[model samples]
Target: MEERVPVPPPHPAQDVTEHVGYRLKRAAAALRGAMDRALREHDLTVPQYSCLELLDEQPGLSNAALARGTFVTRQSANVVLRGLEDAGLIVRAAHAEHGRALPVHLTPAGRQRLHAARGAVYAIETRMIEAVPAERLPALLADLDTMAAALDA
Candidate 1:
């Protein structure tokens, strides 16, 4: 005998633009496009910049960790790391000491590039921040964190 799970009844439909998820996606796309343009001037992509930023902060993250932090696939992170290597922006161990994953570190050039890229990215961030009320910024940021946590949970 098969037992069927009850399906919840559909709720009333609304315009996508009025929905939170739609707005989030739209906002994300705009931010990504703006970041792409800003980073392009520095000859770096968002994922590459993100990897460098993480490497700068932690200094020895594996490609998998970088990919996870950047919300990318491991293969994509590998490609980004290779590109950075080709640009003399980062280095990896010749062999892993404990596992198959090689830890990544930013070179001096990567630090320099990150310095410039940070300014551009911060400008974009500042623009977004300014759009919201200063008094509400903390609550807004916290709400965003809560939303992400809900999804993660």
Candidate 2:
């Protein structure tokens, strides 16, 4: 069995900006800003792009499932879906086939839009990842997962 390295105890930060949470939030905001700018050319907000991406990958996902995947509230997901439907990018069944879940699927137009937007989104990720050493990426991803799991616990 591989031995686990013991994690060090938390240390006090000299300032709020030095805190891990603050740094994470700062990074998230930066990423969001970049995505917002890139996605605007495709006429998509970050949440709309997120929902479309999820729907493309998993057709017939319910609103609640989409909300969870997109990290938005169910109410917000409904609004997003309504907008997509209005734009003819997606379609929801007129009535739920099972329970109260109205399954959402991307239209042909949605698929096209997602494909167009994916390039811009991926380019932003490439730029961000390039800033980090290639060899350290695996560890960085693992550390992020660990931090999220710790808070969720």
Candidate 3:
């Protein structure tokens, strides 16, 4: 009679941690926590900071656009917008030229705050990117986008 070999359990990371959804959620949580801590000194929450960043990149974004960019609901974006407006960090046109979509733009204060917050956020990004092989950075970014797009579809 021949002896039989037993199969070993799959690697936990591959089976669970390495799952696309799990890794995505884990990565998002880690980044969110890091950003939350880093932005705290500036008195900015993650969503608020995101709005500033997006406005800097694409000025005149509507509430809907900013909400989509920041991955928040339109109502939530409105609340953030109100807070920023009260802080004098951004300005929204009183009337929407096209419809109810008020264009949002960052004020000088917003620019300065974003400039300061960027350094801290960039450091976090550098740490994450460095953990992966430098040459694979581009492919990794593309892969991440592809995964996100796959879900969008």
Candidate 4:
């Protein structure tokens, strides 16, 4: 008779706090808190900062695109854009060059503000990366991407 091998049981969390999702949420909350404090010094909110970063890389993005890139709702993005416009940080075209998607552009002042805030944001990210070992940084990023993809699917 052939010998049979037993299957191992699946790993389980001992408590809710021990779950991977819970840990991820805790880390995200901490990061958000740190970013909030850091950005406040530059007179920016997290969503506004995210929008600025996106626009810096890809100028002339529409409201919907900005909303998706910033992980905010279209209505929320409109509000953010309005606030930025009022602050002289960004300008939306009066008429759409094509279709109804009015393009957004960063003003000189907007670029300057973003440049000023980038350092503090980068510092926070640097601190986060420093917490992990140098060799494991790639794996950590990949793991995060995998987790997000799993949920997206």
Give the backbone clash total of model 2.
0
Which residue pairs clash in candidate 1? Answer: none
- lDDT minimum window of 10 residues, candidate 3: 6-15
**lDDT by residue for model 2 over 2-85, one digit each (tens)?**
999966546676777888988999999999999999999999999999999999889999999999999999999999999999
Model 3 lDDT, full chain set: 0.92
Q: Tell me the lDDT of candidate 1.
A: 0.93
TM-score-superior candidate, 1 or 2: 2
Q: For every model in order, what is the number of clashing pairs?
A: 0, 0, 0, 0
RMSD of each: 3.8, 7.6, 6.0, 6.4
CA lDDT of 125 in candidate 4?
A: 95
Candidate 4: where is the Cα deviation over 4 Å? 1-10
Give residue 6's lDDT in candidate 3 (0 to 100).
61
- The whole-model C-alpha lDDT of candidate 2 against the native structure comes to 0.94
| Total clashes for model 4 | 0
What TM-score does candidate 4 reach?
A: 0.91
User: What TM-score does candidate 2 get on C-alpha atoms?
Assistant: 0.92
Model 1, residue 149: distance off in Å is 1.2
Residue 61's lDDT within candidate 2 is 99
lDDT of 4 at 28: 95
In the range 34-140, model 1's lDDT, one tens digit per residue, is: 99999999999999999999999999899999999999999999999999999999999999978898888999999999999999999999999999999999999
lDDT (C-alpha) at residue 56 in model 3: 97
